[model samples]
Target: MSPLHLLQFFLCSVCIHMFSIFTYLVYYYDLFTSSHEAQEKYDFIIVGSGTAGSLIADRLLKETNYTFIVLEAGGKGHPFHDIPAFGPLLHRSVFDWHYETVPQENACFAMENSKCKQTQGKILGGSSKLNNMIHVRGNVSHYVDWFHGKYTKEYIEEHFNYIESNIYPLRNIQYDSQLSDAVLDAAKQLGFNELNHQNSLGFQKSLLTQNQGKRWTTSDNFDTSKYVLTNALVEKLIIKNNKCLGVQINYPKKVKLFAEKAVIISAGTFNSPKLLQLSGIGPAELLKSLNISVVKELPVGKNLQDHVGTGLDLVLFDTSQSVGMFDMMNFFNLYKYFVNGVGPLTTPGCEVVGFVSTKNETIPNIQFMVLPVGITADRGSHLRKSLGIADFVWDNYFSKLFEKYTTTFFPLILHPKSIGEVKIKSQDPNLPPLIDPKYLSHPEDLKTLVDGIKMLTKLLETDAMKTIGAHLNKNHFPGCEEYDLFSDLYLECYVKHLTLSSYHPIGTCSMGTDASQSVVDLTFAVFGIDNLYVVDGSVLPTLPSGNINAAIAMMANIFIENTINQFNLKTNQHMCSRNISFEELFLNVCPVR
Candidate 1:
């Protein structure tokens, strides 16, 4: 056997043993398999072992009497998964669902070629497995709106706190590269206020999920066996009389399994909606187009939302350490990072994050990512320049390698006015979802990113920025680069092609008691379905101004609690009288079977 295959096998074996019995809470439910059908039907069968599913099983497994099965769509972390510097290693690999967007009209005719691929991870880590790794909690208003705006729940505030306790936050994140400081000073000069946290405008720094240089994804935190499923694809929901008894999991090598208890759909926004539709749930009109049976008619694939960032590259002097682009020493530094958990390779070129409001007073809607170096291009798919623009955006401003170049990505986050959708192309699970993010379809969204770019440029003029030799791209704007570079039209065009999804997709299976727009209730159950729930970003009522992986972990806890309470429906009288705090509810219960 090839050495690479042998190494892969060894890694898989080690990972399995490390995670299995100690943390994994999987329960098999195939009618064709073990007659050990004698085991309790289980309390729940969690599907799509990604962000939400991982957290859900971690909490549920605390109870010994109840059984939980977490079915993953793919296996655990990749070789580079644990390495912070190798963040791009997981992109478009076996883990990503390289979905494409339907041509958007509002965007420049130029965007169709420059921006097409919409990426989301398909592995145990989910998108958290293959993202830029910049972490933010967003503004406080993002959550306030969710509690007061839609779900309108009284206990949501407390639930939010519970979410914070479930995981360890990656802190003490800093960069040894001067490029990191240059990006921040540039933004500050442009008039944008730097925040300590990624989302809050009051100076919350961009807090990452990295712990001492290693990625802090579930595998690094939770019991890997409990959440990370290897090679488990959920074909469809096994519904009996409108209730989800289990899932139809295609394990390939093993016979199919039938989960007895309830089925929770955490297969991300796209897959969860498609699975629901495949099992006869979603918009009747769209499902009809697919010629599939409609079980419960609702907007399963509607109201998609994502934060889009527009890339504006500036060619600078090569002195800037723009990642592995220069110094061979940088690669050696990365080697130190993965092996010894220190040095340049561990930092994802993003050190200082900002949370600032634009000229508008309505709300802070843009999230700017400060990169230490210039980005090459979208790493997902190959460039299709023949369709439109340049083969590669040349560094018009830079003359040599020693000239450090700084790239600023202005992310127009969660524009309330803009919305997108997901659709299934066929019955096949292998087909990527028809993800049309309908970005900038809303004029206001364009304005947000435009103002953000304007703010970014404005910050560069500040006194602190002069030390870094920062300059606006007078020639970078598509139509109006020369017109002050921050003119309305220049900002508009930049916002259009420059703004792309942060890979944080949610709101499709929004959570609420209201059925008109919501796909799941507060307990995460499908409104009309008897025993099913969605526990991923698909269920988020609104996008928090920050990173979502943290929230996904919290929501899993809330959903598990709700499911347990519902399962023991008769105990409301006794349990309610005892008034056990939500925090202590699971302490008395044994580990889940």
Candidate 2:
């Protein structure tokens, strides 16, 4: 409050504001300057520039002689995308696809029209550009089952390490908060142990896909100037004689770019399935209804899964105990962040994370994210609109806590029993798909989420929480006022009304040994299609124990490695079959070590 301090604050505010404007200008400049005609053909054609797509392009360019082109539907990324705290601000912005699910019968009860906003990144880095950048490498068993024993724990670990070394190593949040410390203490008080790096259960500071104070994306690992084509919206796959040979792009101008070797679809969970269905490679009945010719009869948009969770707001008696949005974005924090590369701005919303199990302690069913700021942190400015929360619910419930100092926790169901699917609304590639996660359709999924809520309520009663004077916000939710507040029925009603997607969508195009049930095989090749592959989250058969970005990167790494090995194997077989001396073979073609 002193004169010197006030003067410094004003100067810092001006500098930071100008810096933000500079980032925006830079982004637009890249968008305008980066558009040119792509090459006529490539060794491989990638349909997206998201987590999997970006990694695949970077790896292929660096590890092989093959040339590839990445077709992205979005524009270049902004520098704000590198700041962890600014993630939520990008949700409904131009950087996001802003897809929404259809009205649900059993869940998302309180949102507007009973629809949940599914925010997918439309920027160059894809969802990684807008996501919180939480780096969770989930349990190894998931890979074993999803790949049908083709990838073991050791193999998964090796590829995970490769991704870390190549892209960005995981780092803990540089900023510390009283709320994070209290959550950790409460977990210990409740008999939960600290989690090891490899364990999927228990409490620990979240490892993020960040280094220093900046976020890292798969796209950052490569040179976008040469490989990526921004604003290149792929309309459909160019298939001939049941083989995918190229893609038809509708952006910039209508053009066809062929693939010499293969066509890989890495356009995340929703768009990958949408692209396939548009190109005549999905369910027969759906294709027929739309009057589109069916290229393959296999299922393309079946078996959708996401980590569904609900927010729990806790108001603290002492304002200093919680870091409000103002406190985090103040001049002091901004100054520290810019000068020292460390501060509250480094927070990815969730500071400390915990995993708990209602059935067994070892296998956690719930993943708890400890957010230092409350849902009302922005006073319903951006969060409300970004989440597409109905105005009535916001006015009745969240608006009441606008001035309160609070912390919000998100308890996500690590694995849900409910299953849904993504289908094309029509044959049009420009339209967003019909995504119905069908959350809580299975009775067990609802019961399990309610159990997770109860566990969090217990954490509020812990002595550590008492020191911070933490208590659940008692304001009655708009549609859930019939049941007694804090009661089981009331919590269940609250959950149904306030359900949220953790942004971890997967399993729309699953892989398996059985062609009848899966879309891709062990080699990630399309079930019946030649030289076509799906190497993204869509191919994951089930949900992992935590955030799935790490798993997606691992899949891309393993796929490229497998492709290289296969090529080498074919070359070896062809050469060895001939009656040639080992010396001659080594001297001419295959070199000896």
Candidate 3:
């Protein structure tokens, strides 16, 4: 080859290398720069820019002329957060809140100091950015039971339809694993209906909150024109004479922001109540104990609920046939994912889901997720460490099973009977809330979980599962050696030691028509405070029978629609009255002091 030809090839190579470097820089810049500085005031001030806050801002900006500001406590999420398989990997990183429950008497027996680890997202998208992207609307019966007398079925249907239209498209993607197939076949043999989407019931491949193999967080879908203050922590609501004016934010410095129309707290279940209590709106006695003046007497953090379940590890004899975390982390797999956006990286690791009823025929009390790979017992592994599993707990029950290809059956109790509470440990706003989920405190919850374990064990005995050579490890847990393996007593002991949170906490600040039973009224306003509202999972009256993200998004959409309708009504009324001044119209609508 001539020197001229070789020089040409070298020039092309240099151009390709420069282009790759430029692409990476652009991606990093976009990923890290998703925050805007806080303004002095706006029409609406939304706290906690998680799932609901993002959607609310998008709808308000698009549908109305109102200007809004969203305050997020964490910075922009990492680019890896968009990878579906990295769902669990984001925890304990800067993205996760890393909140843990106070010591529990009835549950989390295997955890360090009897405290279960609670993970919440602190990034721009909130918990949605870090959550397993399983999109489920829950059973219709749950909605009917919770809102039957309160809301008409037509009203509920309208909200659900709106969510289906706007949010991530829900669809079941096929996996190549034989383990997923076996689980589905076992469900069919057990007489469960095959449902592949949100509107139906029974066992099916789960739908994910992904768009074309990428995790679609609320931040990704939010309108960019709206203002958002990242790394800004809301300390308290600015209330005067039973009316909310704005919020006091701490973005490494003190800043007071005013909202002309209303202040909405879209903080998740735990933080929402904590913020309310800090602002002197909660149970009067609790507020008094904290030495804060009582602004409103209501149950701010009374009914904390979450999905609790026992995870059973089943080892597969064929390790070569299954994919694990190690296999997915290699350079070849990374190249495949970067080039094609398809591989193990495209899945949330929860491929199949089954909803079942142990007692009530219409309502599904138990929900199961089938994970294809075995969870690690050491903190060295990214998946296990990110899950915040106690080191001792893993060593005692799961260390031995780490040698083979493993599949875990997560049997979650959908509607847990055990009710817990979130309370303020101190008056300081910077401190985390005292989260006591009190899992399995109710006797029925324990019995229901034990029944679920037995049901799964039965499923494992089926011919489909047998074809995959699935078998329970049967290794004795630390505190369960007294009873025989697979016995009810043994399983109950195992469950108490191994039950973990499904990360779907809700109902801290419940919404209802009656003020005595709820913190927020039917219109989502604080019972005694004016110009204040809450639009998040905290407003959920009861835990839905599936993943709470979709339901929370639906609730936010409905709330935004209501706000828009109210705004339009006021605007039309003002237009009809030519003599009405702008100030007078504002007072008539907001009435803020």
Q: What C-alpha RMSD separates each model from the true structure?
A: 8.4, 4.0, 8.0
lDDT of 1 by residue, 465-506 (tens): 657666665555443455556567766765665445567788
Model 3 steric clash total? 0
For candidate 1, which ten residues in a row score worst on lDDT?
378-387
Candidate 3 wrongly placed segments (more than 4 Å): 1-35, 148-150, 174-176, 196-201, 223-226, 312-317, 377-380, 579-593
- lDDT score of model 3? 0.78
lDDT of 2 by residue, 1-593 (tens): 34643454465455445654665676578667875668888989998898889988887888788889998888786666677887777787667888999999988877889999999988888998877788877788878888778778788889988888777668887776888888899999998888875666789887888867888888988898788888888999988898999999976679999998899999999999999899999899999999989999887889999999987464444465545566666888888877776888888888887889988767889999887777666665566777888889877887667455667688899889999999997877888999999999998888888898888888989999998878888898888889999788988898899898988999988989887888999889998889899989899999988888988998898998888777666677677666878677766665443
Best prediction by TM-score: 2
Candidate 2: regions farther than 4 A off: 1-31, 312-317, 571-581, 584-593
lDDT of 3 by residue, 1-593 (tens): 24643453355345434533553454356446645566787999999889899999888877788988998887665465577766665666556777989988888887777888788988778898777778887765565555545666667767777777776665565433667778889888887778744434478776777776778877777654356777788999999999999999886679999999999999899899999999999998999988999999999998999999877464444454456654565678777777877777777778888888877585688898888765641213444554455777676766656455667789999888899999998889989999998899999999999988878888888998888788787688888888998788988888888778888999889988778889997778999899999989988888988899988887788788889989787777666556656787677753333
| CA displacement after TM-score superposition, residue 260 of candidate 3 (Å) | 0.9
Number of colliding residue pairs in each model: 49, 1, 0
Question: Which number leads on lDDT?
Answer: 2
Clashing pairs in 2: 110-497
- Cα lDDT of candidate 2 equals 0.83
Q: Return the lDDT, model 1, position 115.
A: 50
Report the CA-based lDDT of candidate 1 relative to the real structure: 0.61
